[model samples]
Target: MSEGTEPSSSSLALLHHHHHHPQQQQTPPPPPPPPPSTASPSVAGAIVRGYRKGNWTLHETLILITAKRLDDERRAGGSSSSAHCSPSASTPAAAVPRSAEQRWKWVENYCWRNGCLRSQNQCNDKWDNLLRDYKKVRGYEARVAAAHAGELPSYWAMERHERKERNLPTNLAAEVFEALTDVLGRRAARRANAAATPVSTLPPAPIPLSPPRFPQPPVIPTAPPPLPEPAAAAAPPTLPPGHPSASGTLCSPIDITRIHLEMSSDSSESENDDGAGTAEPEAKRQRLGSSVVRSATVLARTLLACEEKREQRHRELVELEERRLRLEEERTEMRRQGFAGLISAVNSLSGAIHALVADYRNGNHR
Candidate 1:
């Protein structure tokens, strides 16, 4: 009985060893420890879980997720969804992700890029209509983004069909049309106002009339009148003997005859002396002729000197006039150049002002 029991125990041990070894081989190494829990329940995880559990609405979920993603992307220096999702891409419009934060960012960027802040009611009509449609279709967030970007389908039959399917309101559509009409009216009014405005242009200055200067008549020197010829010197007269004639009686002819002979001799001597005096006057007349010639020569020299002085004065006046004309021409040229420069400056200033006004309106003043 002891020997039989020992054999049975060995068989049992063998059975146990075979069973354990096969089981160990078939167990598959306990499935490699379940890969560790990498996903932790942080704020983002809680939000995502809440969305999946229907604790948050679709729009709210989208908003929260978009905000989280954007923040992460920004930190990582990657593109934001709002910037990457453009309508020009081939991606279906509905396929684009829905997020309130992304929509808001898209709208803000669109308005800035297209200068919609200053846009008139008519300019904003399409966006308004799109918003209305989006609200009806539960796509308000998307509408907001598209409207902000100032992008809408063109006015056409296709757009109309799409709008109808989206259940857009007729009243809202009418408002958009009305806004366009208002814009047209305002533009027309502005054009009319511009036409009515008067432009001021200064009249050309009157041309001055200068008085003409006439040349004076030439002056001629007048000659002095010639003197009349002097009369010949009068002959000397003889006197009677006053003492003999005191008794009032003349001497006898015979007695006088003897005295007459002596008187005749005396008369001859006197006549010779008179002839010599007459010859001296002829010499004096010749000397007077030479003095008159000298005076005439001096008068001619004075007239020539006066004529030369007048000619010199006239030449100086002509030179001065020419110089004045040249100076005036130079001044006119300088004024023309200055006027051109002024016009260029005014144009540049106008352009700068326009750019500045545009930047301010777009909220880009900085």
Candidate 2:
């Protein structure tokens, strides 16, 4: 087909098909649906329990979820913020769909790694209901704590006081006169009694006209008495019989051995004393430890008692509120029934009066 002839429509179609058809290869089938997500049920359950127990906050859960999602995205070779030049070019990861249950799973895994939770089970609906009730209890506790903290005054007491003040009629004249008499009488009596009291006849104390004299001390200290000189050693006694020189010296050697033995006994006794001293301290420490344990146990029991009482009081309050509501409902129903009966009675009375009037007009009383 020459440019001048302008190719026919069928010829153009054939050329177009030839150019594009060969470039297209058979499309491969999509990889089998990703093997069911490998999420651990244990991790999910732990997250749920921890949240319900108030051990983990919602903020922390959100952080863990975000980190897990980002990690997952990275592993899947998804684009990150750095992959783009402009900040706006990358979509925020938070924009992705995130649910509470999904976040809980991430938190559970995080807690597991941190050793925050011990058990690994699926967080079931049971725990969810408990957590809801627990939140309500916590809210009531917070309100109580706030009231005790004096963030808001107790309105009930204030209202009671106001009512009392309003009911009591004031008498200004009587109050003022009584107040003046009570104050002035005591003051006048005090002044009169002071004036009537006798004065002491004792003379005034005398003052010295000259400077005080202090005791004087000698300039030099006396020398201490000299120590007495030690006595000279006595010569060894002469051998009595001279049967053998060694025998006489034998007694001397025996004396030296005795002295040595005495020194050794003293040392052993000192060691025994030292051991006894050390044992005393150890015994004292044991006693102190026992005392501390006793005190701690007492404190624990006191706190436990306080907590139990507080819980009991809250239960009573809830019961009272339910009872009040029930009573109000009953009262409302009774009032409604009373009104209906009252209207029926009025209608019946009117009918009887009308019948009596008709008989009177027709002389039926005859």
Candidate 3:
């Protein structure tokens, strides 16, 4: 019985020794390292390639593998057509309908997850185009603010600013009134001056003509007492059969009167001719003066018209400048208000995110 008990004890000890060995206690190899997780970099490349081909989604692993194989093709190159490419296609189709804020968040996550080292400017340019579409759904001012914040594209910002300037209200009536006032005042002043000026209708003075002067000869007066005998009495001499001399020359009173009358007629005719010749030059000078006055009047009228036009243009420019300044002020005020709203919204969003993170951490801890 002792011998049988000894053998039983020895067998039990051997079993115990084997169970205590380090090799037997070792853990099985960790389930073969989880089969390397079939999802790979090729999957991401495939998704990008699908986007290039206008495919909204990629379901097959083969497509993903092909995308990985042709990774260089995804980059914009000479052969690639921008017309066929959709920038948003590079993102997951499921995320397309997300809000601008959500899209931005996803982009940030994507960069981080993929270990992309793109610059901030590159990120801004991408978001800018995305925000332009959001602007159509949102209002103009909201879109403008998003663009200014780098959430929208730079081109959209410029276009929106231009539109705002074009649509701004103009004060045309004020300009018109100012122009009218300046024109009417100048016209009224000119008319008043014209009315106050005296008009002269009297003929211009004739140029003075020097009178003809005759030299007076010295006068010698001789008083003769003897009376001359009649020539017919002294010459009554011969002529035997004809006594023509005796009838002597007795002057005819009618003949002398007729000769005097002829002389007076000649004098009257000469005086009339001289008067007509002297008046011609005076009439010509008067007409020339009238022409000069008329020319001056026409020139003054033309100058006044030109001045009035210039005054009107100046008034318009002034009004335009004022309107532009007012618009600038209004735009500045609007920008200030929008910035305030943006700041408030950003603060609220940040607080919400922080709260969400805190909740997640607490839940995890629990």
State every prediction's TM-score relative to the real structure: 0.23, 0.26, 0.26
**lDDT string, candidate 3, 164-253, tens digits:** 464422221233323334444554554433422221211211112212222212221322222224422332222232223112221333
For candidate 2, what is the TM-score?
Answer: 0.26
Query: Candidate 2 residues 302-348, lDDT tens each?
Result: 65476567756766786699899999999999999999999999999
Worst lDDT 10-window in candidate 1: 198-207
**Clash list (residue pairs), candidate 2:** 45-123
Ranking, lDDT, top scorer first? 2, 3, 1
Instruction: Please give the distance, in angstroms, between residue 34's alpha carbon in candidate 1 and its true position after superposition.
Output: 99
Extract clashing residue pairs from model 1. 110-149
lDDT of 2: 0.42
Model 3 alpha-carbon miss at residue 281, Å: 3.4
lDDT of 1: 0.41
Candidate 1 lDDT over 1-366, as tens digits, reads: 999999999999988887879887668966765543333424433444221221323333233333333433342232223324564652554466446455444443334343333112222343444433333433333454568554654233235556565444423334433443444345444433332221110111111111122221222233223222231122122224232422222233332232233233223222334333333333333433343344344544555476457545654675699789999999999999999999999999999999999988889645
Q: Quantify all predictions' global Cα lDDT against the true fold.
A: 0.41, 0.42, 0.42
